[model samples]
Target: MPAEAGISGGSCPDFIFPPAETPASDGMTHPRNPLAAPVPLFYTCPMLTTLAIRDVVLIEALDLEFGPGLGTLTGETGAGKSILLDSLGLALGTRADSGLVRTGAAQAMVSAGFDLPADHPAFALLAENGFDADPGEALVIRRVVKADGGSRAFVNDQPASAATLRELGGMLVEIHGQHDDRGLINPRGHRALLDAFGRLDVAGVAAAHAAWRTAEDALEAARTDIENAARDREWLDHAVEELNRFGPEPGEEATLAAERADMQKGAKLADDLVAVGAHLDGSDGGLAALRQAARRLDRIAPEHPLLADALAALDRAVIEASEAEDKLAAAAEAMRFDPARLETVETRLFELRALARKHRVDPDALADLRDELAARLDRIEAGDAGLARLEAAARDARAAYLTLAEALSEARRAAAVRLDAAVATELAPLKLDAARFRTVVETLPESGWSPAGRDRVEFEIATNPGAPFAPLMKIASGGELSRFILALKVALAEQGSATTMIFDEIDRGVGGAVASAIGERLKRLASGAQLLVVTHSPQVAARGASHWLIAKSHDGLVTRTGVRPLGADERQEEIARMLSGAEITAEARAQAMRLLEAA
Candidate 1:
């Protein structure tokens, strides 16, 4: 065995074993040759490559490297073993409180590095957020907690936010703390986990839901328009008919008013033009009178020089009067016989003016109003048909969505049956043989429906026979909850992301065979992914493929915490110490030896 006696404690080695080559298997089964005796297989999975923590709580400075398989952290109470987990949680972006910083320390820093498989989702998440990460290198996560309760986070040496750290950390490591708020305890995640377990078509359901929502929106809009149109149907119908009868055109009012003005002015100018024509061209008018005077002056001019000048002036007056007579005749003709036409124009103009006044708009706007009213009336008529069509579409969309959701729900229920059975097997081994694990699948009301589906999935348990099941969070005692969490984790280990799993003393209240059972399950879980367990049970600690010891040391001035990997000898000593406390007896050492050999 690699963990032999007499090897001193130091940093964990950078070596890991590969997974056994075999057919697919679940937590309860391991594949092997049919005729061969059961042989345990050691395998490596994604691991926390290293952790460098400084000035965090009780720890002053620490650097640790972790190998694959179950790496157990063992120490006496108050040895600051938990500070390692606390620092790791801090680096994973947990909320930093002021007390996490050591006394007189300016700030505490924790940095963790992970070695992951090429296809780990953390790589995808990092790429999606434009962060630099290489699968070939260790992915680094760092956090700084100041004495004043302020904090900062970084990823791969690039500045990042706490949220980013939390999100990415969740994909890389799952820390199942004693608190309910951490890990898979939250009910909100239950449905998704169930879906993942069942391999249900989540994207299909989401698409169907989106389609249904779109249909609902369209239906609501159509209904609103129809309702509004119904309220104005009567007025709109009347308006449409009236405007159609009026047959108003763009700029018609201005055109008709102009025509009316021309007709009235022509009528007023007719008499004046006729009177001027009579004065210029009638027998007693200016032209004839000028002609008579010119003839008399011409006859006297031959006899007198003064009469010659007068004859020339009379001839010019006769020509001027003739030109004036022709212009007056033209003007009189243009103004004549338009009184009946003027009456027609005035009637039409008045009608248009009245229409404009009734509609409370300019005459120029009449055509636009007519078209608008016509369109509205059309919609009012079409709304009934449109509303019916949209309603049908909405119904179809809802039915389609429900079909998929119902199918997914059925699949989840089936998966829950298997999950419950699988976890039931784990419970008995963990010393909860009488406890019942149940996955409740209940349909949500319409008001509670969401894109995920209409079913509410919750994990519940009954700790005793014939007891009604309640939510896991309400289990009351922390020990039972932790055990229940452990069972659930073991059952679903094959379904989640490629993350390093951490169980913080989940085997706190159990021992002997129960602790050994937990250890066996933890080893099984490690076959799929790396596992870090903080445990006080020698049975559990002995099962570890690798082990670490956390201890406190003081130089008389200040106290500090430290962690070091236990070699073969150190592991046995630690396990013996765990079995018998500070004073180790020969029986305890022998038992620890037997436990290591069994592991």
Candidate 2:
């Protein structure tokens, strides 16, 4: 609901089809400014020539030339039109028909020459497939079928595969049939159709979807981090508390405790042992006897210094004995221990050691690791702000998408109005006055849109309004489907384009004015692009600016189909025969003239 950029607020880039100056297709919506139309082709290609073939289906040594305008192929049932189409398809790299080679020929060959502009899209394809070119020469593609059913392709003499041939072939031509409805009917292809239809809003929806993904990813990461960090907060707090209380400094308490414990256990025994040692040394009682002897020695040796030295030695010995007695008293006084303090130190050390064992780490690492865990917990607590930012981004993205989608919806509605009116006009002459055809414009939720917008526009019909609306493809019978396709092709003209459009028996089950209407539509379609139609009606056949008659022939053992470009008199004769059935009556000839004149 937020304010989004306005529709066409210089946002959607305008599409301008360039070769410039094809009129704004009258079939589609006409804005004040229209895109340029590409230049039309001037048929110069050597694409399949009815001119030459070898052992291919019912076609052999057949020669045919097509024009830039609509070309119709007409023949009696089973007379070989399908075979010609098959051969063309083969040269284009379609699957092989090993059994289709002429009755006795070793292989089949389908060759086509194309005359295209120097910058033609098809030319690029030919070159990409490794075909050589002579600057102005038209492209040549050929497929050869071996006797054993194997097939090979060549582009301008360079060996190529059937796949490469098919790819290039598809670009150059499109063959359509009632059952081959791939482009307009498939929902998977709808997005591209809308894009070509100039619906720019779908792009906005895609942008929004992308923004949503990115924002969602960021939000998820933040949530995970918060959960992990928060989960450890209680444990981290406990660890820091334990470390703080212990106050384990470097080795001081451990040294004091060790010394005290050793002294307490040994002090009493040591005191009694020291008293015994003093008695043995005669330090406490025979001191006077030793002193009197030392003095007599000093008198007798008055003339000898050795006697005097001996008296000094005795005095030194007495001083050392007194010093030893003082040391023993000190040792005895220092042996007392305090149980309360000892128990405290031992418990703290045990706690550190036990924690280390439980955690599989060294005791020294506990404090540093505690700080890291605490930091992680704090980070988790901070993720809420990031999640808020993501929510905001997703909102903005959706808003942007909706804004664009609305504008695209409006454009589609406008196109729908014009399209319905035009198709109705086309269908009226085809004997469907009661048929109500419409371009259904429904506004769907944003999820339905691509980059173009949230509008699902389906070409629908109420064979009668009381009946439920059904898509054109779903309800129309074969003949009706053909008519409907013509109406749409006429309504769209060439700007609403496809790479190829094929019509198989679109002319079946209709004649007179209805057939004429079909012909006009085909002509209109051709003006916009290429159209290949198969017809049994002379009216449809006569309308083609170019003509190919599919005929079957027997030469000895082979029954084959052949195609040829009809000369003017021959075209008239063919149309006459169509009007008069199996016989070419004069009346039918006159009618053919009138039809060609009106066309």
Candidate 3:
């Protein structure tokens, strides 16, 4: 199917919403979820309240106040209408340069004030970014452009960057033109517009995408680990087995060396133990002699009291000798050594040292190295299982993402149905009744999937019957494109955040009834927000709720451009002038009167 030619009627076939299944009609009944809470009215829409421009291009000094409802700016071809828009653009954070300043002026200044509802999001954003804005009053944005092309920006009297000004401006106003860089024409904003229309929870889809990516990352990491570990698997296994066989224990080397030293010392002490043992228990030793003398004295002790006392002293000395001998015997027994056990311990200690040297580690650290190697081997053994688990998680995550994306796609299709019907209704009024607008949502290939979703969305159009539909940017003429943009703005107005909508000569080529239809639509579009149109059509000018006249004048020595709000009579005269060139006639005034009345 061609881009926009995929659908025939306003009904979207892929839409799964309740009321969206019905065919397109002039009027649509959007389905409300029963579980959804009733919407509470918060802030009234914001509008452009004041604009001041000085030394800007042809505009020397200009101040304009805007109220609610549809307003029109009427001027001759080169009467500085573009200056007004450019000044507003400057205030809205457009690039500032010397070209914008008047030829003789040193600098230029553009300031815009907006009357926004107290609950407007811009205030919160300002607070978040540390910009002071009094929510109770109007929001002000000011820009200064110097002759040297330097620029400065301020919001609510607080110094700010151009980006801040641009953000605030985006929420405050939307300017639509044939070649505007902002607004609904930009393809980047199409998805958001559709989601807003559908009232879909796009954040949910984003979260799902994030989850999917996380899972993908986890799986990839696991696979990479496996690949890396495979290269070292053989060495790791051999090292682990060797360490296990040696069975190195903490402090084993030091303990074994201390035992070996003790055994060597005991061997040297064995001779000394033998000599001491012989003296203690020898037959002719002092203890044996003492024992014999004590027995003789014991036998004669009854005959003499002195002899008895001497015998008792000898007996005490002999007892002391026997105790000494017993201690020597025990000491000798303790000195006994096992040579085979000592040799085994020495061999084991040497092996441990050799293994430590092989691994380039201290003997004390061998145990830790062994444990680390074991852990690595275990991980390699578990690699296949871990990879399988990660793969399962990735699959689950992808499923979750697909589910959310499919649901979001269904919601967008439903929204497209209502949007198409709404825009379709706007076509005849804008003199593009033969044209068709479509929100094309095509599923992308898996490789092309991103965080945004698995779909590509574009706004497409067909200008004439039987013509192949193409991208809106490629197919529509400049005038037709502007009208289409206007229709889309009207269709999405309720969902739009901007409080002010400006059209820079959207009514460029059309006249007669087509211009009248554009005026009527503009009036309808201005019901809740503010609308400002730069137009040459008398019919459109006559329908203005408020009118401003832009004209260039010569003040003797200088040329200047001035704009002022016109009264009822002035408005009538301006409209008459638009209808009858330089000469305003009675017939033209009558027609202007009729047009104003009809409007």
Candidate 4:
């Protein structure tokens, strides 16, 4: 065996020996002959390669290496086997107890290492929790518990929460005890297990459910809008009618104001034109007097040169005066105002300004407001038809969801029947022949519907023929419960199973043929994965590819628990010890040899 606690290439080591040429249905390699070929360092399955502990209960400092296949640990009643399991649980983020620390120790620490396949679920979980893990790399989880009961956790040497460790541990290993609440024993996981066994796809049902929710939401929103519009129906109709009658146009306010200003200016200039018309009215006016003086000057202009200059000036003045009079007459004609037209323009401008104020908008935006009000009124009028369409769509979506859910429920029922039969076949071998196993698939009410469909799945068992079926946890005997769990595990095989499994004294109450049967099934299970069995049964220990003897030794001052890895001869001696009470006899050795050979 390698000194380090991890995977390495070598010949079939004492830790892992498979029987001659057996094909595994779970898609893991089983060596054709243990002595002939070298065992590769990497296996398709994930493996718990190492567990290191310090100052935890009776264990002081311990480092143990592991490998693939069934590895058995055996010890006396007070040999600290429970301590080993507790240490592993601490590393796996179980509750931290200060009492677990050793005497005079400040803290207890445990670290667990695993070699995983590229596609293991733990890698994805690490990523989800903000840790980076690569394919083909070993994962390490460490936990430290202070004597005061505080704890800290690390994943791959990076700081993490205990919750994260717990989640990752769930994916890496499953520890099955008589009263275990996790894995197959938990009712919550039974549905997923059934689906995995049947390879059922739930994506279609989930999509249908989501579609139904979206359609219902849309229908509800449309109904709310219609109800709100109905509340304002009278106001909208009145507003639309008022706007339509007024017929406000873009820029109409500015246009009306400009026209009114021009009319008022013309009216003011009418008085001024009348005053100017009086100055050029007749012969006594300025234009007639200038014409008379110009005629007189024209007659005297030929008598003297001075007289001619005067006549030219007088003629120029008369011509300019006549042009001014003509312009004044035209101004009077253009400035002519009618009171009726001014009054009409003023009234229209007032109405436009009043409408703009009532609507709280500029005149230019009044036209857009009119259109919006009209649209609201139209929607209120068509509210019943729109609601009908939306209701139909919602109904269709609900129908589709029901159809898919019904199909899924049917498939689950069929899968449940097959699973029950499979579990039945395994029960007899585990010495539970008289017990009955059942997979219950019950339909839930509509209120209980979900993306997983409207069905509830649970695993129930009856220990006796006429007994009522009850949950596994409620079984009267721990040994029977453990046996039932083993049977179920064997039947399910690799379906929804963790890569590594630990059975804590699963063979506690049985021996001889039954113990051998449990050992055989465990070995078969280990063919595709890793298993660590804590056993008192010599038969089960004899079947181990590797054996560990957990012993508690005391020096003068302190007692400590340690694990010793056994070679082939050492394993045989341990099995002999287990067979014979306190002393090893010749017959026990021979029997141990027979068991080993049979394995």
Best by lDDT: 4
| Candidate 3 error regions (>4 Å) | 1-44, 118-130, 134-137, 158-164, 221-382, 450-452, 465-467
> Could you estimate the TM-score for every candidate?
0.66, 0.59, 0.66, 0.69
Error of 1 at 378 (Å): 8.3
User: lDDT per residue, candidate 4, 538-588, as tens digits?
Assistant: 989988889999999999889999998998888888899999979999999
lDDT of 1 by residue, 1-599 (tens): 11211011222222222112221224443222122221221222567889998898778888998887788998889999778888888888878887999999999999999876576677888898899888878889999988987888889998888889888877778887677465677798888777665546678889999999999999897677667768988887888888888788888888888777756677778777767767767678778888988887777798987789888887888877777777666655555547778788788889988998999999889889898777666767896687789989999999999998898787777667666765776788888998988899999998887888889999999998998898887786676777888788766653544348888888878887899988887876675567899898888898888998999988888888889998998888888898887799889889999999998
Instruction: Write candidate 2's Cα lDDT for 1-599 as tens digits.
Output: 00110111121112223211211225543441142133233222223323257777666677566555577888778997777777777887778878778767889887877665465566666666566776477678889888786888888888988888877776666555566454455444443443443333355566765666676676776677678667876776776666556543445445655765755554446657556445634533434455566677767767778877887887666566556655655655554444566566567667767766766766666666566555666666556676687778767766776666675666666555555665676767877776777776677764564544566667777665477768766765666777776766555443334424557788778888888888877775565454568899887887787888887887797677767778788888888887888888899889888877777
Candidate 3, lDDT over the whole model: 0.80
Deviation from native of the Cα of residue 378 in model 4, angstroms: 8.7
> Which candidate achieves the best TM-score against the true structure?
4
Clashing pairs in 4: none
Better TM-score candidate (3, 4): 4
Judge candidate 4 at residue 167 and give its lDDT: 85
Order of all candidates by lDDT, from best down to worst?
A: 4, 3, 1, 2
